[model samples]
Target: MSTDGSAESRPAIDSPERIELVHVGRTLQSLQHLRVVAASLIVLYHTELQITRLTDGIHQHSLGFGAAGTDLFFAIGGFVLVYTSHNRKDTLGAFLYRRFARIAPLYWLFTFLMLGILLVAPSYLLTTKGDFWHFLLSLVFIPYPHPVLGIDRPFLFPGWVLNHFAFFYLLFGSLLFLTSGKRVFAVSAVLCALVVLKALFRDQSHLLNFYGATVALDFVLGMIVAWIFLARNETPWIIAAVFLVGVSIFATGVLQNVSEGAERALFWGLADAALLFVCVSIEKQWGWPECRLLSKLGDASYSVFVSHLFALALVASILRGLRLFPTLGVPGARIVFLGAAWALGMVVYAAIERPLMRCIDRQRRPRMARMIVAKGP
Candidate 1:
C-alpha cells in the first residue's frame, strides 16, 4: 500500500512472482487483518465499559484487556510510517498532509457531532461538557483537561488517540528532510529522549506529561521492527513462534492488569510490536487467504475506532429504552452492541469517510498536476 493508505496492485499471493515481490514491496494482508482485530478489541472494551455503567457494576467479566488495542495501534502506526515511506521520495509537506488528511476529516465531523449532542441533549453524554474551550482545543488537536471529565479527553473521547497521532506525525514529518536512515534514528532518539526526560523530571505540565509517556516508545519499537523486517527474511515457523511468544506476553499483561505507565508500554507495547512484526513477516513469506469482509473492516478500522463510541451509546440507549437488556442478558446485549457498532462504523466509512477522502484527493490532484506542468518533465 502507498503512504496515503491506498492499496497498490499486487500479484496473486500463490504466484512465484508474488513471493519474489514480497521483498520488493507487497501489501501485507496480515496488517489489515490485525487492524480489524485492533479496532474490534477497542469496540469490545468500550462496550464492556458501557455495560458496566448501565448495570452499575453487575457485569462479571472484564474486557479491559482489549484496551491493549491502543498499544497495538501505536506499534502498527510506527511500523506503517516506516514501511510505507521506504524507498519513496515524499516531501515533508506531502507526508504531513497525507497523515492529516487521513485522520482529521472524520475526526472533525465527530467532534462537531459531539458538540451538537452536548448542546441539544447533554443528558445523552456521560461526562463530556458543552464547553467551548474544550471543543475548540479538540478541533486543533490540543490536549486540555475536559471541564466535566477532568481528564485530557476531547469532546469526542476517541479523539484522544488522534492527538497522540498528531504529535507523532509532527515529530516524524519534521525529519523528512533527512535521509531515511537518519529520519529513523532521529525519531527514535527524540522519542527516547522525551520518555527519559519525563521519567527523570516528572514534569506536571499537561502537554509535557502527556507527550512524555513511555507509550511513545511503542512507535520506536515499531520502527525497529520495520528495520528488522526490511533487513532479513525469516522462516514462517520462526515468525509464527515469535507471534506466539508475543501473544503469551500480551496475555500475561492482560491477566496481570498491567495497564499503565512503563509497565503497560513494556508489556503491551513490546508484545504488540512483536505481534505486528510477526504478522507482516509471516504474511510476506507465506500468503494469507483473501477474506474480503475482514479486509473491508480493516479499511474501515479508523472509522470504527473513532465512531464506535457514538454507535455504542446509541445502541445502549435503545437497548435500555426498550428494556431489552433484561431479556437479552449481558452476553446477548454485548453481541448486539458489538454487531451494531461494526455496522454503524462500516456505514460511516462508506457514507462519510470515503467521500471525504476522495474529495480531498480530488482537490490535491489538480494542484499536483499544475505543479508538475509548471516544473516541466
Candidate 2:
C-alpha cells in the first residue's frame, strides 16, 4: 500500500505506510473547486463598484475594502507553496524561474491588453491624465507619483494584487533558505510585531505601509499550518476553535475599526490568521469534496482572479449597450451580472489564459534548458 513513488515509478509495491493503491482524485478536485469559490468572492466584492456609482469619490470609493478575498489568496498561496516546495528538491534558481514563469508573463499580457483597451475606450480607463510614464513605472511595481491611483489605474482594478504578489514572491520565495522550524517562528514574530506596531505607532493605518511584510506574514501563517499538519499527520480541532473565536471577536465588534481607536484591526488580522488555520485543517480532516468541472475552473483560478475585474467592466459595457445599468440596481440584475462576469472570466481563462500559459511554459523551458546547457552539467 505504499503511496510514495516518483511520477516515473511503475509497478506499485506493498507497504504499511504507502497508500499508492489508493486514489485521492476526489480530494484534489474538491480543493480545486473551493479555490474557484474563493475567486468568486473576490469578484462579487468588485461588482459593487457599479452598484455604488460614485463618480466623484474615486479614492474614497476605491476597492480598499476588497482585501478579505485577497487575504484568502495569500493564505492559499502560502499553503500551496509550502506543500509544493516540500516536494521540490530542485535548486532555488530553478524554483524562482519556474514560479516567475507561472505568474509574470500572463500578468504582463493582460496588463498590456488592458492598456490597449484604455487607448480605444478611454471611458474605461481609470484616469484621463495620460500619465503614460507613471503607468509604465507601475508595470514594474513602482508606485507612480502625484496621482494616488496614477499609473496603477486600469480598466480592471485588481491589478494591484499582482503588485502585491510580486512582493510576495520576493519574500515567500526567500523562505526556502530557512529551516522549517525557523521559518514558522520568524513569520509568526513578524505578524505579531505588525499588530503591536499598528496599535502603538500607526494606530492601524493601511497595513500596506509594510504591505510586502504583512502579506508575507500571512503566507507564513499558512506555511506554519502546513508544517504542523505535515509533521503531525493530523490537524488539531483546537486550531479550528481558534478561528471560530476570531470570528466571534469580529462579530461582537471587539475588532471593528482601528483608525478611530477601535481594536478591530488587531482582531481582523487575528481572525484572518485563524481562517487560514481553519481552512487548512478542514481540508485535512474532511478532505476536498469532489467536482471535475469546478476543479478545472480552479486550475484556471489564477487567471480567473487576475482578469475578473476587467471582465466585470467588459460585461457591464455590453449590458450598458442594452441600457441595463440605469435600471439594473435590482438584486436579480446584480446577481446575474456577477454570475455572468464570473462565467465570462472562466471562459477567457479556458480559451485564452490556459493556452497563453502553455505558451509561456514552452518559452520558459527552452530558456531554462539554455541556461542549464550554458552551465555545462
| Most TM-score-accurate candidate | 1
Writing each residue's lDDT as its tens digit, candidate 2 over 182-286 gives 656665566567645654665234433344234445566566766775576444668657767867855544334322123323443445556656655666677
TM-score per prediction, in order, is: 0.91, 0.74
- In candidate 1, residue 132 scores what lDDT? 78
- Per-residue lDDT tens digits for candidate 1, residues 46-157, read 8887788668788755675777788888888888788777666667787788788888888998888887887899888768767778889998888988898787888788
Off by over 4 Å in 1: 1-25
Over the full model, what C-alpha lDDT does candidate 1 score relative to the true structure?
0.78
Residue 335, candidate 2: Cα error in Å is 1.3
TM-score of 2: 0.74
Model 2 RMSD in Å is 6.6
- Give the top-scoring candidate (lDDT): 1
